[model samples]
Target: MRNSYRIALAGNPNTGKSTLFNALTGLRQHTGNWAGKTIALAEGTVEHKGKTFQLIDLPGTYSLFSNSIDEEVARNYIVFEKPDVTLVVLDATSLERNFNLALQVLEMTTNVIVCINLIDIAEKQGIKINERILTKRLGVPVIKLSARNKIGFPLLLDTIDRLVTGAIECQPIPTVYQDHIEEEIKKMEPRVSAIIGDRLSARWVSLRLLDGDEKLLQEITKRLGEGRE
Candidate 1:
C-alpha cells in the first residue's frame, strides 16, 4: 500500500457502512479503542492503482452533535484530526437523516463522498435516487452500491482515488440556518479561525460550540493553546 492517501467512513447506524468497509479492505481491517474512550474504531489500508490508502471506520450515528458516545467518535475524527477524505454513507431508504450527518462532516472536512448504500432494498421499496442530482447538490461524488453484492466497489475506489490525490476538488455544500444563527456564526468565527486556519471553517466550529459539546469544546480549546505554544 502507498503512504499518500487516507480516508474515513462515517454514517448513521445500520447504513451498511460496516459491510462496505469490510468489503473494501477485507482482512486488512485493524481494530482498537480510541484513547480515553472505550468505543472502538476499525481501520484498514487498501491499494488502488499503486496508491496505498488508509481507511478508518467510525461508529455510526445520526448526527455529530455528540448526543451519544458513538456520535462523538465520528465527530472527533472529522473535526480535530480531519482525514484526507471521508466517505459519508447514506442508506438509500433513509436519505434525509443520513444527509444530516453528511452535511455536518462536510463543514469539518472539504473532501467528502456520499455512498448511497443498499440500492437493492431501495429499488424493491420503489425508492429511486437520482445519484447525479445528489452529487450535484452536495458538490461531491455519490456512489451507489450494494456492499453485499460487491457491486460498484471498483467505481467507488476509482472515484476515491481521484478525490484523495487531488485529481478532483470537493467544495462542501453550503448549509443554511436561521438569520440569527448566521449572524452569530459571522461574529464567533474569527475567534476560532485564529486556531484552525484554512483547514477548518470557523463558522462550523462555532455551531458545534453552541451545541454545548463540552468535551469537544475542551478539545478544540486545547488545540488552540497547543497551536499558540
Candidate 2:
C-alpha cells in the first residue's frame, strides 16, 4: 500500500498559491466551500515517489493575526488540523510584503516549506533572493520557482517527500519577541504545555494567550474541552 500525507498551501492574496497547487496536482483537483463558512476550499491529490500527497489550498490572507474570516480560516486550520506540511507560497517580486504571512505561519507550525513563487518575474525585475541563507535563518527548506512555468517542481516534490517521510529533519527557529513579551511567554508556557501538551506548540499557545485572542481561545476550549485549560 502507498503512504499518504496531507499538505496545506498558505499565502497572501496574489502570491500564486493556487497556481502552484494546480501545477502540482494538475487535473486531480476539487473545490468546495468550507463547512459553516463561505470561504472556498480547494484540495488535490498528487502521486510522487510511490506516495500520495493531498494538498489543500487555504484562503489567502494578509496576516493570520487579523480577525477577518479568511485569516481565521487559515490560522485555525493550520493550528487545529495540523497538516503534515504547510507550504507557504510567497510572491518573489514583493518578498518583503509577502514575508509577513510566511513569518506568521512559521510561528504557528514548524512543519513548513517556504515556496518563493514568481522567480521568473523577480529576475526580470532585477530582484534576487538567497535561498540558502533564508533556509538557514528560518531552519526550514526554501524553494524558489516560477509556479506558472513549473520550474523547480521536481525539487519541491523531493523536499516535500523528504519532510513528510522524516528523511529530513526540520528545526524551525522561533521568532524573537520583545523582552517583556518573552518573559510573559516563559511564565505561561508551562501552563499552556499542561493544557495542549504536544498537540500544539506550547510557546505559540502561550503567545496567543498573551495576545488575548478570544476566538482562538474559544476554539481551543471547544476542541479540547473547557477543562483542558
What TM-scores do the predictions have? 0.93, 0.96
- Candidate 1 pairs with clashing backbones: 2-52
Q: Give model 1's TM-score versus the native structure.
A: 0.93
lDDT of each: 0.85, 0.92
Worst 10 residues of 2 by lDDT: 220-229
Model 1 residue 210 CA deviation (Å) reads 2.8
* Alpha-carbon deviation at 198 in model 2, angstroms: 1.2
Regions of candidate 2 where Cα sits further than 4 Å from its true position:
226-229
lDDT of 1 by residue, 31-76 (tens): 9998788998788988889887788999988888867888877887
Return the lDDT, model 2, position 64: 89
- Model 1 misplacement above 4 A: 1-3
